[model samples]
Target: MALIRKIIKTSSNEHYPFSVPVIENLKELDLEQDIIIFSGENGSGKSTLLEIIALKLNLVRISLDINYSDPEFSDLKAAINAFTVEFSLKPNGFFFRSEDFISYLRYLNKTKVEAEKELKRIETEYREKSAYSKILASMPHKRTLNELDNLYQRNLEEQSHGESYLDFFKSRLRPKNLYLLDEAEVPLSFQNQLTLMVLIKNAVAEGCQFIISTHSPVLMAFPGACIYDFNQEVIKEINYEDIEAVNQLRNFLNDRDRYFKYLFD
Candidate 1:
């Protein structure tokens, strides 16, 4: 079952977020399926709506925090306040945004390195101390490093970007919750994207709900999903075969010569 049943925005504001044509025309979005996808061109309100949903639901973010009070969304604070979210069951979940993924990886690696350095310093500082006292002094740093190692077996930097990203997403999954992802396919290739799509399918089958905003045809092809296209004047549910990106990719591969000739000419 879907965690959130419906979302209603009760404000009429002439602001950047509200002024964005798609958002301006949005009435209320009813989520009837386990996966609700937001698809549109960049600069459309796809990401903006994701932000608002993140704020209203208080979904757990990876390495950054966002609220109606975020300075970047200052103009839309009041508008967000007017949002009303109805739920079948309110469950906790994680929010993943592609832009913040790298920053999160850096944070993990930096913290791990600092802990290792602290352990070394403790060893030197307590050189003259008894073994028990030295162990006591260094316990926290050792535990920190151990926990990080368990969380990510090797340094994230050592892993390919795609591999690391997929592992990170997998490590965060918990059954029976909602997940909000924005362009999560950013760091993945076609094969890795297939892996991601499989992961989503498994999660949904295990009773998790997903709201993903992405452009990847692989992701948009998720079976039984409610795909919302933002390219129109108003956001509307769209058929998978009719999605702009899907047909464009299909056309490009089927007639690359025509495209190349057109471009060269």
Candidate 2:
């Protein structure tokens, strides 16, 4: 499993100053483990850094087949173009951002609606232009329409957001790739986070590398993961137990009554 050895922020003087200040001061990030977890609070630049790395590595965003561009990406692209990357190997993988998951769900619904509309049009055309309809339909292979219709019939939008998100991810993730995830715990429950942990474990076992930025104690607790704390705007490796998310959970669980008393008092 070849990893991204190093990422150094070369030139900081760019058009758009990084919204997250932590990113501007980042001199280098060393990837020493197969599973790297970036743990940080809001505005800590975890996602910002992950996006730059993912784009530099050319990782595709899962569930987004269409070329949908965001104006924010252009700025990031320009910034990442200035960074120096050292990769142990040319990696291939998908970048999963929490925001993209939301957009993907909307895309799924939109696609389903469009497919239904197309189906209706085909039906109407078949009635009016029977001979020509058969030609047009056959040109696409009768199976093409049926296959798309079948997909719409079992549309992922029918499931819960978490379930559909998992389904979409499962459908995209493949073996032997570098998966960069930013705040992946966004749409998942505690149980689903555990499920994702299992999936990541299996993927790593099968030669996949994962670099995730998250605030979930469950995700940060991934077995043998290299956890980088962004609490002070420095990406420094730390023990899992030292992670704020993990410690907060530990403190609350250690004395639930005390936590409640502190909160109420």
Weakest lDDT window of 10 consecutive positions for candidate 2: 145-154
Residue 241 accuracy (lDDT) in model 2: 72
- For each candidate in turn, the TM-score is 0.93, 0.85
Clashing pairs in 2: none
Candidate 2 accuracy as TM-score:
0.85
* Cα RMSD, each candidate: 2.0, 3.3
Deviating ranges (above 4 Å) for candidate 2: 14-19, 62-73, 128-132, 135-154
lDDT (10s digit) by residue, model 1, range 1-265: 6888888878777676788898788889987579998888998888888878877888888855446476557866556876888886777898889888888888877888898898889889999999999999889988888887787656677898889988888877789888889998899999999998888888888888999999899899988889999998898999999999999999999999999999998
> For each candidate, how many residue pairs have backbone atoms clashing (under 3 Å)?
0, 0
Stretches of candidate 1 off by over 4 Å are 65-71
Q: Model 2: per-residue lDDT, tens digit, 84-106? A: 77986788888887777767778
- Which ten residues in a row are the worst by lDDT in model 1? 63-72
